[model samples]
Target: MIQNKGEMTVEEVRLNEGHAFLKGKLQADLLYVGEEDGRIYSLSANLPMEETLNLDGIVNGDKMCLKWEIEDLSIHIIHSRKMNIKAVVTFFASVDELTGVRLPVSLDDETVSVQKKTMRVLSLVIHKKDTMRLKEEITLVSNKPNIAELLWYTTEVRGLDLRPEENSVKAKGELFIFALYTGDDESGTLQWIEHSIPFNGEVECSGCISEMIPNLEAAVINQTLEVKPDADGEERKLQADVVLELDMKLYQEEDHEVIMDVYTPFRQCMPKGRKEILESLLVRNFSRCRIADRIEVKETQGKILQICHSQGKIKIDKIQIVKDGILAEGIVRLKVLYIVENDEMPFYSMEAMLPFSHVVEAKGITENSVYYLHTELEQLSTTMVDSNDIEIRATIGLNVLVIQCSEEMILEKIEEIPLDQEKIRNMPGITVYIMKPGDTLWNIAKKFYTTVDEIIQMNNLDGDEVSSGTPLLLVKKVEE
Candidate 1:
């Protein structure tokens, strides 16, 4: 019942190496119109953006996601006449960013080595001919009879979906529009009107590999809307021209394995231990949360007639990883529009902040895991239940990705093995030994001052296992 013990040496080894970059032009077409003007003219555009990452590959390494930036944007007037106008918006984006490392196998392979020195890069060049086009006209909702001047507008893209296609990738999402303008009622009194419009569109990325997973990230960088009165219309009509710039990035996830440690217990050595940092993905999950609340509209503003529009934003304040789940806390910023009792200024606006707490079910989450969370306001609605109270209901989408980075001490190899001459010389030349259960070749060889190979050669052993009461021939190694 002697326990075999040995000291060992270890070294760190990197298994795979690669680099990441964008291989093509990231393009999106946004076709929209002003709500107030029947005829439109482009004023100015600016693109403000936020960076995002998405994982779109198989569980194994070799799937690619896209990381991109908008370098240049342009808007062209395709058709400009009367109250109706059409324009084409183009996004010239660069996809040259790398996300976190992707490792395929967790900790199963022993001999496999992966060292990712540089990430892999995929490039896409989107020409005008390859660009996807979106066309939609927004109807104006206003109590005023005539449109005066379109002031400004803002747009947001939400509920984005990236799907892998045959030699391409498809991006699908919704657009939320907010427009403000001055208008005249029947009495010719100047008043302000705010309107919201929702639209949907899809874009296809050509020349993409079928195996490539498109991780799509989009943001509205710049938007411009202008209103111009059309003299030809019998009724008081205006032309509205709208322009927007959107930026997108796509990324693919890569996975592989590397050898962490190696050891042999039969030899006596002063093994040096070394520490190495290993990185791997823990979990990726998507969940939907519903939030319900009430807000009071002051009576001085006016009696609530109808809920016209609602928009919301979610900010993640804190995230904690606990056993079997994740705890998330955040605040929801809401803005609602309602019609008033007066016809002169029929629309009234109100803002409210709602705090929320939610627990997402994620198995295998631990305190040592690192995570990234993205929250989106998917859908929002507000209803005027009474003259003083407004009912608000919203759906938020949360996407989380977790990664684990841990340090491990590995055993490389044996450095030295000191032999005992006296013990070797006293060993028997030939002996008939009865094997018992739980007997191993290494243990028996060590007891006889011989090596496992020598015993195997002497007794013509087929395998390392031995049965109880089985006779074994032991011949000690003779000193030359």
Candidate 2:
């Protein structure tokens, strides 16, 4: 509310419309693959209302007009269940020359927002057909009666086998996901989580892992991630260039290492009271769903909105994610940065953290989303350490409002789209009139710069046509 554009002040700006990890392996098998933790059960942007945009009762200083209404509204999601497939600090690896090393996986989610002083965010969506399952929907319309919240996350990885091994065979990988966040009163419910880590690192040095060999030439194991937002736990620790690539067809070359399990989520911000048209209680039939590409109410809480919904997904390597089942269909992308109306205690909520991984034999086009990997060998050699410990959490909700913005200035000294002929001789009816012969518009608007119903709406004459002498084209602001 601090936009002092040289105020002569007379403003009434009419307007309104707005909206994983893994590690482990055989120092024994030369490092097999181990080390990972988990947490990801997404699609719960927050929902709960009933306060009605401030009205303890004020009786003064221009109330003009403002209104709102909403009852029994709900929407919320946050769930997971995949204890620990198998990992003792070796779920992602890369170490094979003697023969072994191609494991590294771990992916987590991020995207957040919160404002207060004005708010009218009416949308936030992330639906998937992988991980285990998925769904999340949010919509709003308010003037009064408020409570807003939306926060999302994404992280993933897959089986990393790399093929062709003998003296050491230990490449085991596992990750899963499931979500359904669309609740205005419980309807779309399903949030499950699971994480199993086992990817021992090895790939001493051979040469030939990228030669067009599907005859068997594939091994791309990459895992790189860095997300920050730590209120008290000192967040931000992941440096030295992120890299996770696994593509093979048949090669004697070897230098592979994979280990993943770094799912982090902790988004929080809550405040509510205003409504007019709110929805999200889960009842999705999106006719199959397809329109993604509009996310930006301030990043809408993200992992790039889970890679804009979902697709093939190739990267510099983030951690823990494998979606073949959890839900299906992927590809969600959007961008609209900001449009705040005012600002200061109108609505704000923020929370984020979702670790992901999926794969249970559920491939391509059930609608869409199909990405790739695997590691496994349980002889407990890197030092035998495991006991079902999969943990990664999230809680994202942010609402902040204070909006009323409109700018269209060009008055400096006045009139510049052509027109200043000496201010029309100080305006207010310019003199010089002599063209009788049946003049019109009531005799040329009495001869000069204005009136006569503004010269019949500035010469669009129909009831002011003066025949015999035509010379009319006056201007000084005339538009009904």
Candidate 3:
């Protein structure tokens, strides 16, 4: 086999009590040289998959998100026309629940005082998954050769631009299409065509509006290219159909006056607290990194003559948050087909794994930050350096979206009861108090069941701000 490419698709996702059911399929395209005729040929295969996953604290009505990757693929040849393909797929699932804290803003008793704070938080507006279909008919130029038989092809979706609308999203991108075939000439030589086709489509997304923050992801899940006859009855036109999968998440910014601490001076009150995490969108960046290397060919393989076609895929192994930005380490799997200096076998192919490390600039990224990164091969080319080495130059595109996560103690509930009368009555009417480190006027007032204004008035202070180790007089309030 010369080369193979595979992709995964999720057909259905069902959520039940503490469990999730997934239905998907793996599609692969393979290219190989024909043993009988010594010509290039192609084969396609599909493998259906069904899996049940156990999820803790998951229900039917909760929102669940899922993602998958092709961890590994191995192809074994058993006979001349049969092979065993093994694929290891990994799926990640998550559920997002909307949790809130209820804070007491006011007390019924007139003598009680409440402390409030204003906080900015992120609120999720919508989370959904959608799909879009694009179709186009491309005609070859006059100088290019007509297609006789197509052996291999590849499609890449890049430069995606999305805009929010009232009830949908406008998406636009370019498809890089490449195909290798034998021309309709007597020579029967290999000919290839490459083109960049621009396409735009609209996705129906409920509750989507303009000026909303959107974290969107798109992928070319399925595509097809076929040769067709033109109006003059010549095989000069090609029909292209593509399907794109969209993962959309939108958020809105809101401000609320939350009660950080609550205490009632007229009675005893305590706040029941719980830890909650809040996440906000930091930045969305699309960056590019270049890769260049040389592959040395051994004498046993063959001698190169001319380059034909090259294809590649990027696989990210690890990502880390560093001082300057996010560091991504990964490998690029590249396959090249070329003409060899031989009569029996005129074509040869080779595969190489090139390692790379790149740093994406993110100014304020920390350890607590979360990121979603996707890598793609924007451009790749192979050139013959000498008889035994090939030079490879490629451009890798990086799309990253980062969010900041922070934890806060939220007041879930507040319990209030009557104060102890004996303790209040035994307290002295007048006394001298000395301030210590980390002392605040509000803390002292809450301890004595008084107000900050009364403390400042009794101490003859300028304001609530007071230094440590300062001596002041305290007066207990008496029932009128």
Best by TM-score: 3
> Model 1 over residues 417-465: C-alpha lDDT tens digits?
6655566556667888888778866667656655666677777888766
**Which of 1 and 2 is the better model by TM-score?**
1
RMSD of each: 16.2, 33.2, 3.8
- Per-residue lDDT of candidate 3, residues 222-245 (tens digit): 798999999988888888889988
- lDDT value, residue 261 of candidate 3: 80
lDDT of model 3 at position 475 = 74
TM-score of each: 0.54, 0.16, 0.83
Per-residue error for 184 in candidate 2, Å, reads 43
Give the alpha-carbon lDDT of every model. Answer: 0.52, 0.24, 0.81
On a 0 to 1 TM-score scale, where does candidate 2 land against the true structure?
0.16
TM-score-better candidate, 1 vs 3:
3
Backbone clash count, each prediction separately: 54, 210, 0
As a whole number from 0 to 100, the lDDT of residue 461 in candidate 3 is 95
The lDDT ranking, best first, is 3, 1, 2
Candidate 2 overall Cα lDDT vs. reference? 0.24
